[model samples]
Target: MGSRITSPEDAAARTAPPMRSQITAPVAKMALSSRIVGRGDASFDGAVNIRVETSGLTTPPIVTGKVPAVGSMITEGKALLEITGRPVIGLAGVLPMYRTLTPGSKGPDVLQLEQTLDRLGLDPGTVDDEYDTDTSRAVERLYEKAGYDAPEPDGRLTQAVDAAKAQVDTARNRLRQARAQLDAAKDANVRDTSVQQGAVDDAEENLVDAQEADGEAKFKASTPLPVSEIAYVKTLPRRVDEVKVERGGTVDGVVMSASGASLVVTLKVDAQTAQRLKAGMAATLDLGEGTPIAAKVRRITKNGNQYDVVVAPNRLTPSQLALLRDANVRVTIPVRSTSGKVLAVPVAALSSGSDGGSRVEVLRNGEADLVPVIVGLSADGFAQVAPKGNAELSEGEQVVVGR
Candidate 1:
């Protein structure tokens, strides 16, 4: 059976309208999409930008060796490039290498170097500011792992050490001769014995001076680290973004640029929206691949009237990462949600009553009856509805949308 309806104008005019129609639809039982009021959609305009600057220094400053490939991940204690036929290694440290480090050198830079070496299992002894013999040996190991030879001390220093050793040997020989002479003079005369004893004492003192000189010379002859041979990076395992120097080109200014290995998505929002967001909040990333990826909020910063939000995606497979390396994507964060399923109806089915309360028309036994309802949430052209007072409403029920 079909439903019937009468218009107020037709009844008041004492005339029947030529045509009247009615339509019907069923109520929907589903979840309603809701979001925080005053919030807008967030999207990434482009890929993450890399801006970290790095450079190398050498005597010739010429790139005569292998360079890291662009987009490669560089780890700690790995060689970044080759300069002047020597490998320039990258180590983890906040302080930059400003001066050449050598034996007997002591400072905060040396301490940082020692810490880095120990982290790499190079065994820099004592991990102190003073670079001693153990530190020199550990540096040698560092160079060995990089497939290069450690720089040697100056030739003049090695020659001085040799000369000092020779002087000590001569003094020892003289002391032995004086002792023999004293032994012979002891049987001859007391005055002769005293003179020989004085000669022996003088020879012993000369030997002591020569030995001290030799010790100083040896200290100066330990291994040395040139400023150009090492580069200290604040973080390890960064991705190579740009390589400015080629194999035959000369190094000038910034030689390379790198940043964090993992990619991040950035977007701008209003201050109110930013306040609702915090670090580690879950989000969905849409790369336009027909599937959404999981992501989280990394940080939020203010810029002028707006705020910038950085989102980090979960660990992506190599293929997925490569596919979306430099592409734009959309992100969606849910700020509010319904607790469970509820009866919902199209917004058109809802109407305001004389009491200013919401109500819906339900079709029952070919009769239209008004059911007073309370609207919980309205979104996406749908409104969540619950029966008010004694009125009854359930899922899969037919409702009159028009008459």
Candidate 2:
């Protein structure tokens, strides 16, 4: 047998067993957080049916034109329809216009009308319960924008006002004539001046009566808001769901039905998840179109063990609204999240340190080094980590996830 000479490297290679593959992963930059997902259906909120019925018309109110189309968005001060050659304007208010608003009309409904006018930038002077000339002017502007004239006080009232003015003039003329007769009697040194003075007194009394009648008639003839000319809706910018009346149809009850313009997703989740959600919290909605839509928490209601979560989506395009309307969607809300990108590692790589703190085994020069770390949010099988004390960890550094 011959003796074999071997170098140190060869001897070491022969003594060492076949190397086994080690399982390791690199540190990554990512956001870590826990998320709550729930299935929900999209729907519109605050639905309302619109009705425009006119009274006191000699002829039936035929919808001549300007009928709003279904799916159209009706905003404040917008015309809903043209009835009897006049526009029926829509205004936002909770109170229905039950009666014609005249100069003396005073109530909560009047205040609502004034406020709606102010919101529309029509400047209804002061918003108050009493309807005044400013409100009437605002109403006129509203009608003007709709390409029509505002409803005026009845012609009969106007004629009465004119008649009252004529009476006032006649009474004044009679008082002047009575005074002239009294002066003539004084000039003639008449013994019985009582008759002339009595005539003057009677004329004065008649004049007072005439003045009172004139004031009353003028007040009755001020600009008036006819209930038939306006429609009150609880919400503005409402989506027209259905149009019950056509152009040539007669104006009747329930001309249209509408709802809130924006769409919301309603979801039911467990109490635990519901507790983590809050109104105005950011969320994402998946419509199964590969693109997620932005949304926010609108409200939450509890019923027994289940809670209802309402999520309001950001402004969606018309096409997007069409796609989401009455469709099932996935809602994801993150209760906790990292502020931004941070150092992270697989949850499997984390282990209990000697002092019960968290630690990761970093591979350096074929040796394992225990680096103490503070664990942050853990999500998706990963945890945000920060090295403790003088220990250092960085991205792309290999960490032992498993043997």
Candidate 3:
């Protein structure tokens, strides 16, 4: 039956604009988008600027070899370069290798070394600070594995050398006693006696034995390498950032630069933002031209009012890393994120109701129905919401965005 608008109010209501218009498009019945995002400005310092320096050495060392390839990521327990013909192993540590370490040496440096070796599968016996025999053996194995020779003051050979010296001392004592007896007989005017003559002969033979023993003891193989010859770092598995010297070049201090195992992206933040950062927190790195790379918070350092946070990439191919080095890039971090996708609508479509609760004018079958919804986070002009009552709303349903 055709109905007529009997009153002006009815006519005005019927003739008024269909609260909103709808257009058909080849789109989804249900769509999801980000509800919250965090943005920040990041000045790319490029890849780590590495100027390889010689691990502390007292004297200038000649670079006998450049063991690691340039731009190579040096993993844990590896050498960065050969200093004075010996590889200066790079380990992760804050303390510098101060003194020359030998067998029986005890200190923080030895513990650092043993820990690095053990982590690399070298098994330096116990991880104690003492550079004992086991540590020496492990160090040798490490050197051999790296295709280099272990430095001197090695724990393995020191004991053998000490024992040899002790034998020489005993031989010398025997020779001294025999010589004293011969001298006494000669002084007593027994020059005509065969016994005195025999004593003299025995003394001469003992002296010869002692001399030979001393010569053999001193000739025993020993390492003249000083503790200073080895370079120590605090951590392991670092990447070779730069190579400063080539083979035959003098390592007068600088050798090469290396970064820790994880490539870090350093950024500064205000106190408010710094509070949000934590180790292992996730972030996004945008280099402007390419897709954003994923990263995690590695560390944060606070110095006075300035706070610096370090970030690391979850994974990056060699080519990707090559392209990113020193490249000016931007990074974005999401301060808050939802566990999963949620229903969201334009904030403009939301309006107040008599009860002061939030509601959206939903369009259904050419009619306007107001449905109450609970509001959550609002970002990018969209607010996360859920049906407040029995009112039903589904994804892709038409809702009035504006008057």
For lDDT, the strongest prediction is 2
Give one digit per residue, the lDDT tens place, for model 2 in 1-403.
Answer: 2368788898999999877766899999997878998889988876798877577566788989888777789987768788878778898888887888887789998998888889888888999998887887887888887678778798999999999999999999999999999999999999999999999999999999999999888877877888777889988989888899888888778889999988999999988888888998999999888579999999999978899899998878777888898999999998899999999999999999779999999999989899999999999989999999999999999999986
Model 1 ranges with Cα > 4 A deviation? 1-58, 187-195, 303-305, 339-403
Would you give me the overall lDDT of model 3?
A: 0.65
Instruction: For residues 47-105, write the lDDT of model 3, one tens digit per residue.
Output: 34323344445457677775667656655445666666666665555666666666667
Q: Order the candidates by TM-score, highest first.
A: 1, 2, 3
The lDDT per prediction is 0.79, 0.88, 0.65
Error of 2 at 252 (Å): 5.4
Which residue pairs in candidate 2 collide?
Answer: none
Q: Indicate the residue-level lDDT of 16 in model 3.
A: 87
TM-score for predicted model 1 compared with the true structure: 0.75
The backbone clash count of each candidate, in order, is 0, 0, 18
Candidate 3 error regions (>4 Å) = 1-59, 67-70, 75-79, 92-94, 120-127, 152-225, 244-254, 261-313, 328-343, 353-356, 362-370, 390-398
Residue range 200-248, candidate 1, lDDT tens digits: 9999999999899988889889888877778777777788877888898
